[model samples]
Target chain A: MEIRIGHLYPDLLNLYGDRGNIQCMVKRCQWRGIEASVTEYQLEDPIDFSGLDIILLGGGSDREQAIVCEKLKTIREDFKAYVEDMGVVLAVCGGYQLLGHYYDTDQGRIEGLSLADLYTEQGSPRLISNIIIENEDFEMPFVGFENHGGRTYTGDLKPLGKVLFGCGNNGKDKKEGILYRNIVGTYLHGPLLPKNPHLCDYLLKNALMRKYGQAELSPLEDREEKEANLYIRKRFLERQ
Target chain B: MKVRRLMAVWTAKIISAACRLSGRQGVTLAGKIALKIDPGILRDLSSQVREKIFVVCGTNGKTTTNNLLCSAVESEGKKVICNHTGSNMLSGVAAAFVLSAGISGRLDADYACIEIDEASTLRIFPHFKPDYMILTNLFRDQLDRYGEIDLTMKILSQAMAMAPEMKLILNGDDALSAYLAMESKNDFVTYGITEQVFHDQDSREIREGRFCKKCGAKLEYEFYHYSQLGRYRCPSCGFERPPIEYDAKNISMEHGLSFEVEGRSFHADYRGFYNIYNILAAYAGAREAGFALSRFSQVLESFNPQNGRMEQFSIDGTKIILNLAKNPAGFNQNISAVMEDPSEKDLIIVINDNAQDGTDISWLWDVDFERFLDPSVKSVTVSGIRCQDMRLRMKYVDIPSTLVEDVEKAIKDRIQHGCGNLYVLVNYTALYSTRNILAGMQER
Candidate 1:
């Protein structure tokens, strides 16, 4: 079986090694004897969401984020439909902010896709640190890094996890990310998936199950991933 | 006011001496204490320079370029003040001036060549304006510290506006640096290579300035030397690479580097291609400052790489190379430099997530570690605070690696049993400690 991945604005929204998520996804599938091909959707390219099994939207600089917002606004209806169809989408940092209602910044307000019931406001002294989260759906905790100036509030959507360490969401709610259907949006960008193999496989399994009606994935050796994850989890969680 | 300055200088000197006695470098602590006592310490000391002051700023190569410029100026029979320990922040800049001054809080240097951090320009410029600002190149680095490349540019632009009289010496190959020079409307000179040298096929490189900052249009590159440093032109706005005043031609990388700038042949025993830009920036800055070039070749040949900027050591017939690579672009360049050697070698990578090393270790994935899959790289080992992440990154590329928690042990293990050639790559905070470890082993 094959899985198609759509990477949005690869040229613009690629900050902090964001392409590593695509690499992790592609390599894990290829390791399992499953074919995974990626299609990068540029600023002006036509995005056919129906052909893609998974879609990735990474973070970018403020200037690049504005440019991407203008381009993404044109495809709002198509993206909304894709999200409604239970498409597995992972957005991070600035991309995570773009999936909400609007981001109020020092410069002004920038509109998001409004596909999720969330909003973000620019905050002082950016929330930057190594972050860990605990989710009910996964057996193991997730580990990653977070750096952002926007405080997000998931008004009606369920959070992806609870803040085990570091600041999450607004840093006051003790919540992190927004989970709607199969979509995951968060501010973690240690490419968020390579070290968290369980989370990566979850997205992959969702994509696989939706396409093939079954996802009995044979687990690969995750010793390196587990060690890296545990290294962060043990350091922070133990300290607390 | 004069008494306050004198007290600050004396206290800082005593603190620096105490730090040395205690076996600490005190690279920035002295300056930090001095600034607290007398906030105008930098302004008073820097204004005492007898000749021109040159400031080097950029994401990478700042320390090397600044030190080289200092050497070039010193070769012209002039006394110079410089931060030789790779401390480029505001406090470090202040310390360089303070430590170099006499006990009476007076500076008697003929030239001042200092490397300034790009993000700290706003704070540094208010104290003193440089006669010449050399911008080596701009790339994505330490995103958590400095929000983004555009934000960095904005801060630098504001700093430039504060010092209208300072001229810019820019790297013409970098569109971001060139665009900054143009926007500032300063008298600027560019240095670049006209020919394409690095034929790197890695498409995973994150080119920060692929679009034109002037017109917001995509840039068209004829060929990439490496990571967006090449001949580029914007088809929409007619904005292109400025004419090179210090063009490097007849470039050759075999047996170190050999190149020519404006009919003057120069050679340096440097490893990476990026060093060419560093050397050129120094040469151009010295020339623009009206310094004699007769002793430039001698200066370049005698300048040695210290503090893990490609410093070399030999241990019982085994050769070892140590280098610092803090970001993806820098790491990729270091990898290319390592691959240039065909001899079978063992490699050790030390990654740390300390605040100094940029707490985000995600940039490790952006580096093309897959290139180490070559047969010549006999073995790979990971070490440091974030060795697990490094090991995992290597594993994703199908390169089997040994995980060593301690850096000194990792090096000793390779030197004892592996091939005679070894390469050690480290990040910011790991460089000095790793060098100390290597030095200890070599002495024994």
Candidate 2:
């Protein structure tokens, strides 16, 4: 079976190499013998979340974000359905800001899917920086950059990872990423997957297992990926 | 070095304060401040920048192109860093990256894309060691600061020297951008308009940049797209818009001109044929950045240029199209777009005599305000601090101007009863204040 990915607002919510996250995912999944297809949804278009295994969102300025915010209003109900049903979703920086309950600024307020246990206040003084994230349960690295004035105050939710490098998800706060069942959220940026290839393999495996029902999917450890995991894990350990 | 830098800081402060009193746009002030604080401050900040750097530079479409490239990368699910604020310089860039780095000084991401100004490019490139440089477009802007085309070209040459390894993503129509293709070591890519917008003519209105550098010969253009950008080849030097890596095909300049790249057409919600090329450059630059066309196309199709650029706002039954026009080339293109609306819109052209607007206001003479004589344009209202200068320039074009004063009043009087759309053209210094005036008018 093939893993289908939904790229939400590819046109409106993209400002950086946000799509690189998808490419990294597609390559990792395909290398592990999983088929993946990404469907992009634009403004005012129908939100068909059918057969979707993953979704990706990215960052932009307040003005750019505002445009997408207008479009997102109409689809809040659709996004809420995905979150409640335990759909696998990934959002970074502005995308992460957008997925939360609210993204507020001086002008007005823009609402998100209210999926994860996160809330953001735009124009706040809690500007976050580059992060090195890890969770105690999973001895792996979660890397990405954060440059936002929006302060994210996490509520009761499972932490995605702890800080291994520069800053954790948010500054001083041990909260970096949010991991809930099949949903993962963080401010980690481009090249995040490249630095954390182990996460890529694991996410791909998760998608593949659901697609093939654990019957036809390849084994978790290939010679190449096993070497890569070892190397990446050592790099994370060195950071510690 | 520190002592001299301290003195330069003082000099920059004095110069900045003097400029503010004189009502100058703060480009020169901030640039001077940067120059004073550290002669090589840009170099210092740039050294700290982790490689895999990307620099977006152009005249009309730099901001849009930079934003588009950033959008494509972000869609790839990467943490991408760029100047969210319009402060696109050494200091602004410093403020952005410094805030993103760790105490150990490691950047958060594997990539950094920056939009650099034309004038500051030379001093700043040594700092931004770009893996890829998207040279978006080159048009005549702030002739006073840039002097003439040749001076700007010289500065670009100096900037290019620092990043010899940078793959140049160029505008094929632009003489300045295409010139960098001569460096064989640097992998260069070009994007330009393929669809014909205007009838090709040798009219005096065409300010082509086709002067032969070899023998002072008036270079012949196969056509003219806006200024001197067209299919040009110096007969002496054999300089031409190279075979494009990603050429825009079937370009149409109607209703926010859209174009196709590599057989895929993308629509931008804004007008002007120039923007099509901007999107094209973004696509080429992003693709070279290892992003799939599918991902890049997805981001650009829904993108819009903000910051009072081709942005529309309504206040009490008046449709106002606010666009930023700083130099002669930009002002001229904006005029052409506004004139094409066919709805007989009211016109308000704001001019600034500020330093950021360029000390040499003489570039006004270069603008083809003669286009204003068309029937679609009902009335011309001139404002900004340099209103009289624009009035003088309009008089040369025989433009009758009974109403000329503050920007708000001009818009209010012209756009009062049954006016469809009021197009406001403000220079750099006047744009922010003009926008503020519009916001204030809405309050009333």
Best by DockQ: 1
RMSD per model, one decimal: 1.5, 28.0
The parts of candidate 1 lying over 4 Å away from their true place are: B1-6
lDDT of 1 by residue, A79-108 (tens): 999999899999999899999989998888
DockQ of every candidate structure: 0.80, 0.01
lDDT of each residue in A11-97, candidate 2, tens digit only? 545434455566557765676666778787756468777567777877655655667777787877877787666667777777888
Best by lDDT: 1
What number of clashing residue pairs does each candidate have, in the order they appear? 0, 36
Q: Candidate 2 regions off by >4 Å?
A: A1-240, B1-51, B99-107, B183-185, B200-202, B415-418, B439-444
- lDDT per residue for candidate 2 within B233-323, as digits (tens), equals 7777676667766877777766656667788877776777667767787788878877786666557656656667776778888888899
